[model samples]
Target: MIELSRRALVAGAAGATVTGLLATTMTSPAAAQDAATPAGPAASPIPGAYRYKVGEARVTAISDGVRTFPMPQGFVRNASGEAVNDALAAAFLPPDQISIPFTVLLIETGRRRLLVDTGNGPGQGPVGLLAPTLAAIGVAPESIDQVVISHFHGDHINGLLTAEGTPAFPNARVFVPEAEWSFWMDDGEASRAPDRLKGNFQNVRRVFKPLDGKVERYAWNKEIAPGLVSVGTPGHTPGHTSFELGSGADALFIQSDITNIPALFVANPSWQVMLDMDGVKAAEVRRRTYDRLVADRMNVAGYHFPFPGAAHLAREGEGYRYVPVMWNPVP
Candidate 1:
């Protein structure tokens, strides 16, 4: 028999260990690759909606889908396309692309069910989806007791009427901010407005006309209903409104279009989006409001934020950061 030294034995064992490890390592990646892949067909995303509670109240964030398009010139009136693209890149969003999302909120206070915003519906293409999303959550349009519109923007008020031009929420009392109503309803303002803005005035008339002075006008800081208070956050429009919901110790701010697609505005608060009727005023409101929200660690929901737009704000540098609420399957 050949004489085997202790060193040779150790070397042989080491070699065996190396070979085993190599074999395992060589197959591990492929095995992991196979495991990482989804089995069968790729699963598609379902209708967007999330539920949470405030005291005894129930709130749902409903999506009307999103409209994506190439970043256009003057998308950000204050910032150049290059700067806007840079912000998009930093956020890991595809550069030079824009996505405008619509959110319709549902608030239930035991006896009353209130909808904060009526999203773009079948009436508006390239966007509308709120109807089906609400249905997905078992809320029929007729079940809504009140519809509190945040502004006169088409995205916020379009769903007020169904595809057939009838009141979607037949039994609901539609409440719009009084200031918004005064400005948009003014024929002088409509005529003096730029050609591009004429469409908005026309759309507003188209949506609110069927109601025929029936739409209830609400004032700033006033309670529209129990636990729901209108917060005037103008600049996007003369009468743009947000809302605050408080129940027990829980409170939430429904930030309707305060800053569209936070990747740009919230990340750079001074940068103004083209949608703001008064960019300067909008930026000021954004900074001041966000500062307050950050200081209080307040919860917020944005109409133009990503689907399920509820989030918290953090003061980052001169701007703010949007921290999306964690997905909770169990309310």
Candidate 2:
């Protein structure tokens, strides 16, 4: 039995509280001048947090930021670099460069604050903003009730611990797919893994070792909270999962890293990206998932999609197209 920790990092958790000087010095003459200073030369604020509703549940897309790298050969293992470049150009993206963004979901079910995935935790460059974004949205890191991980990938599970290697969400129960845990936690499995995969195996052990007796392993077809249902959409990882949010008569599918940058994979379903652990299985799942999304005309969310990564999938010609949901002022 997992003896989960009940400890919490409690402070200013009753309601969203601004921690900086602005709240206290708003009336000060100095504050007025500071506000007029324009902070610095014109620059756009970092965009991350967003909110919407799935029935009575309040859902948010908290961004962890992005990693932009020069397009490497075999970025799409099955497709040629030239073909990928063409697709990028068609999507109006710069050629020879790829940017992967990370967006985690927050589902507030009136009673429970459930986070779908934790982004790259602190120390990761250009990422690790999940904690701050939660703060901005009035949710203290300690206030999260439970964290349901899609799989054990670094970007998804690294945020589970702090810089010192302790559970970041002290009081929250960490739920992971049982299948993922079994494979990665096995000593024999890691020993036989290829050199390139040794790091991934090591990282998973590093993250969950301390919480061995505490992590809750869940199975597929289970309701994570209330209307949030876990769907087994593996392949990227042996146990990678996606979710379906059903409320009232409405529904939203949470597609977790099933496909990265839809402009590439979603538009060309047959073209496989580099990270599809089981490329064939990944492509199979991708096609099946998108088919349902198109038939249902469902609103969906993707972790690697642009910030607030909520969109609708459509069957274009050979592959499919993603239409982003228009931003709404109210949740």
Per-model TM values vs. the true structure: 0.85, 0.87
Candidate 1 yields a Cα-based lDDT of 0.75
Candidate 2 lDDT by residue in tens digits, 249-271: 67889999889988899999887
The ten-residue window of minimal lDDT in model 1 covers 1-10
lDDT of 1 by residue, 1-331 (tens): 0011101000011112211111111111111112334323212132345556766777766667677899888999978888888999999999889987777888889879999888775745545666754543346778989999998888888888889998988989999999999999999999999999999999999998888756889899999999888899999999999888998888888889889999999999998888899999999999989998998888898988886677889988888888987654430
Best by lDDT: 2
After superposing candidate 1 on the true structure, give the runs of residues whose Cα lies further than 4 Å from its correct spot. 1-47, 123-126
Give each model's clash number.
0, 0
Give, for candidate 2, the lowest lDDT window spanning 10 residues. 1-10
